[model samples]
Target: MLLVKILKFNSALLTFLLFTSPIQANEFWGLESWMNSLKTPDFTKIKDVNQRKQAFFEYLLPEINKQNEKIVQLRHALKTDNINSFKLQKIYNRYRVKEGDIDTLLMRVDIIPASLILAQGAYESNWGRSRFAKYYHNFFGLWCFEKGCGIVPLKRDKAATHEVAKFSSLDKSVEYYMRSINRNSAYATLRKIRKNKRDKQAHITGLALAEGLENYAEIGYEYVETVQSIIRYNKLSQYDYKS
Candidate 1:
């Protein structure tokens, strides 16, 4: 009976591993290997637009899904019945800076569409081949004024001290990217558009929401247009579905 009990425990452990690994270990090769695979030009040069879009989405979908899981878990922690629990209060305290109040924060916790972020990241990082992405995993061109925030841009204006933000890991960069769009005043229009879409539909498409990013870059409307064009030309809207 002892041998049988040990066998049962091993079976249960295997089941648990299968269930948990997909969510936590989506990178089949490991983080650095996964990052290197995305930087390969072979995936970027796929002639078919949908094929190329799929390649990019495949590289990022696991990371995006993981961040959204954390956001959802935090939002669930604030549920009316759970808000006062010690576990939830800890979560709330951690995210209080990113989310001002629970209600307002829930509105911002939703995921940005894979297609929209993909287009923007591709534009910013040159398909992960940019020097910034190479050195810093700074795919979004996000800036921080803190003295040691990240890499200092060579062409930063003589009077400007903003450093391009660096991330310790690629997923950390993606997490910060989503949070910046969600909470930053500069992307209020995008968040508003996203909130409205969430109210109307169970799932929001990236193409519909790209309009609200009109001010995302120095080029303003032109940048929004370029993102939309990338989405349109690449048929990236197909990847907007979460499941």
Candidate 2:
């Protein structure tokens, strides 16, 4: 009876360990490898617009999906007190900030996918080659005219020095990018559409959001149309949806 009881206890503990192990341990490793593969390249050589768009979507969409799934699983593991699962979940959680920012903004307003934001970062900053991006962490081409705002890149302004906004870290840069769209005057229409969608309990749509960002680029209405084209041709709007 003593031996049988010891055997049963051991079996139960093994079962617990197996069941509590992280669900996506292999997947988490895969994600890290994938992220590391994305070495910044010379954007000038990537002159084909279609190719650039494809590369952007291919690189970004999977990361977003993986992070989103990890966030959900981590919340579940935390609730269940699965210590092993929690440890694995924490690895995935590191990427959740970027994913959560996308999810939260989508919940509030019809906005572009986090992939698009990454693409814009790649495009505007010339794949992290620009002086502002390399030194100041200005990922989104944000300009700052006020004193003590940011570093003034020599090539930024033709007539005089133009300050490029800086951030303490990459995460802060991403946060500022999101806030710039959600709160800035140029994006007022986008904010209103998002507010209207939330009030009505509607899913945020990218095309609708694009209409409001007409002034986002110097080309005004043309820029809006171009963004919509990028969304459609690449089927990027699919990333905007949550399941």
Pick by lDDT: which candidate is best? Answer: 1
**lDDT per residue, candidate 2, 1-243, as tens digits?**
985686576557545655786647544433333332233233346678767555645544554455445444544554465547455444334333332253433332223445456546655776555755544556578877786567767655577655778664454565567656754667778767766775787866666677877777788888777667656665666677453
Clashes of each: 0, 0
- lDDT, candidate 1, 1-243, per-residue tens: 985686576557656756676634433223443344344445445778667656666877778778777776666666555565566555455444433366666666667887888888888987665766655666788899988767788888989989998664668789889887876767778877877876777567787778878778888889988999988987777767562
Cα TM-score per model: 0.72, 0.52
> Where in model 2 is the C-alpha error above 4 Å?
1-112, 115-119, 126-131, 156-161, 241-243
Error of 2 at 227 (Å): 1.8
Instruction: Kindly report the root-mean-square deviation of model 2 from the true structure over all alpha carbons.
Output: 14.6
**TM-score, structure 2 vs. true:** 0.52
Cα lDDT, all candidates: 0.71, 0.57
Deviation from native of the Cα of residue 23 in model 2, angstroms: 42
Candidate 1 stretches greater than 4 Å from native: 1-55, 83-100
Q: Evaluate residue 200 in candidate 1 and report its C-alpha lDDT on the 0 to 100 scale.
A: 75
Pairs of residues at least 3 apart in sequence or in different chains that clash in candidate 1: none
